[model samples]
Target: MTSQPTPFVIGIDGPSGSGKSSVSRAVATQLGAGYLDTGAMYRALTWWCCHTEIDLGNAAAITRAAVELPLDIGDDPSAPTVVVDGTDVAEAIRTSEVSSLVSTVATVPEVRVEMQRRQRELIEQIAARHGSCVAEGRDVTTVIAPDAQVRILLTASEEARLRRRSLEVHGATDEAAIDATRDQVVRRDRDDSTVSQFTEAADGVSVVDTSDLDFEGSVAAVMALVDAARRR
Candidate 1:
């Protein structure tokens, strides 16, 4: 029998509004691989805690919830889903409330440890099923999948990030919209950075700046990196 090619595990890390989700999905689709939104795992856990009335400030309680989260996130990049306890929260986890408080759940060291363990398991499962998988999140490149064949840090300017987040949350980039999104996108980044080093690319990781790139351009930039990595 012919030897099967080694599976590809692409790890992407970036801050909010850095085009990580879209770019990663596009790359996964183009490469015929599975896609994992690791950040959504954290957000889903946060939403579950909030929905169950778990206090966000209690580390032990939050860590316990993370350990027991009923998460069912899909790996299909074209039609990914997030189901918790039979409730689909794909859209719910993107709400302003979840975005604002997800950092609180994500910052708990125990919660991070539990989620990282879960993420590695998910990556292994996806790669086994699909021959390859592209996983993206704040710590995907550095922590969750540091040994991935292709590791990238997607970044953009804060001003650009705020504008993109404003458009996403409020459907407008006006001053009022940007102000409304500041707390979720900007403040959350501050809180999340305390636990993950996503601001810069680690040694041996590639960097892709999407500040001036449109959607297609950003996707292409990441795709180029993946192609180069595959050639090595």
Candidate 2:
């Protein structure tokens, strides 16, 4: 395979509100690379499931939806869009409906298997296109790209996460639902990362706690690590 101008990749795996998206994007900007938000890909697929009326509990149907889904990862590093089939779903995929169902759809072993496959393919393609990338998701460093050049595990307190969620989903969800959703998301993370075997980071992965740092601070922290690795 043809490699991009750079071969290095930094993977950031974290639970919600750990600020993986903001951190990864900023890290990519700092490194002059690309960024991939893996969670949005799953959410995009979940949104497609809703649009096509596929039952989340039906593994067979869901797997078929994932397989037949014409998902495209856009070429630009600035956007890195996910266009499903012919439609641009970069915005639609982040909906509360899709966010709530994303864990259920992503948890299905069949769906994870397929998405994992796509995930790896996309990483390689991104590396080919933009040289290096900082990919952020729950299972990215451990499961999707174990051999990545640099792996950063980001974590934060649930309270911080809820605060961030409140800002993001205030219009889409009520306060009670937001509270419940926060608990459910934490539960989903535990289930997928622990019970479902996506918890552990691969060897040489650095774990960072973002409980105190702001978004730019976290980006700076990861960039420091990436720069150090490049020197080695």
Candidate 1 lDDT, 1-232, residue by residue in tens: 9997888999999899998998899999998999999999999999999999998879999999999998999999999999999999999999888988899899999999999999999999999889999999989998999999999999999999999989888899999999998898888889999999999999989999999999999998888888988999
Which predicted model would earn the best lDDT?
1
Best by TM-score: 1
lDDT (CA) for every model shown? Answer: 0.93, 0.78
Tens digits of per-residue lDDT, candidate 2, 1-232, equal 9953567788898788778887787778767776788888888889899999998889999999988888887635467788887898988887667776788888888888898898888888887777887788867887888889898888777776666666666644556756856754676676666424334445788978777888778878888888898998
- Residue 35 error for model 1, in Å? 0.6
- Model 2's number of clashes is 0
After TM-score superposition, the amount by which residue 213's alpha carbon in candidate 1 deviates from its true location, in angstroms, is: 0.8
